[model samples]
Target: MEEFEIDPQDLLLENALRVVFKAAEMLDAEALTPSQLKDLSGALRDATEIVLSIETACGCDHDHGDEEAE
Candidate 1:
């Protein structure tokens, strides 16, 4: 697969919108069509798979919340 560049901000925004859509479905089952929901799920998954994005973007010395204090 050919890798293409996308601004981190843009990816974050898109992922946030996907979360909103996913939440909307809980409020109203018909809020998103089946195909749209599937696409959104894929988008969310893709964003999450970027394991270093959050740490790199924020310059944090953490590994995606794995070290959160209990």
Candidate 2:
């Protein structure tokens, strides 16, 4: 058996990623017009940037989760 260690900072980033993925899944990509897709892309990018900023401000490593999952 193997034991795993979890970091609080990584957990926060994971939660943020989960929220974005869920929101993206809810949107109907195919139904979006060119203009709508442009707007959605900008919104999603902004949301992700904000989350990244939060992670950085908290002094959390962005790649922390990837290392743990390996």
Candidate 3:
């Protein structure tokens, strides 16, 4: 039997995305107060940073070869 392994960076990115999605859902519920909204905004920002960091660590560049033309 063969076992498959998931990359740690990929797993971290997935979890970060999940956190952002959950925060979005909370924002969509329209039941939070102004303070809650501010806190969630911070949480979302942190999650986004984590996702970007993981992408950088994985060498997933977003340039898409456009820079080469310049």
lDDT score at residue 34, model 2, on the 0-100 scale: 80
Model 2, span 1-70: residue lDDT tens = 9999997656766776775775577574457678876776776776687676765576545665475588
List model 3 lDDT by residue over 17-41, tens digit each. Answer: 8888899799788799999989888
**Candidate 3 has what TM-score?**
0.66
RMSD of each predicted structure: 7.8, 8.5, 3.6
Model 1 scores a TM of: 0.37
Task: Look at candidate 3 and give me any clashing residue pairs.
Answer: none
* Alpha-carbon deviation at 11 in model 3, angstroms: 1.1
lDDT measured at residue 45 in model 1 versus the true structure, 0 to 100? 71
2-42 per-residue lDDT for model 1 (tens digits): 99898776677676667767666754765777887687677
Q: What is the lDDT of candidate 1?
A: 0.65
- From the highest lDDT down, the ranking of the candidates is 3, 2, 1
Q: Please, what's the RMSD in Å of model 2?
A: 8.5
Error of 2 at 69 (Å): 10
lDDT against true structure, model 2:
0.68
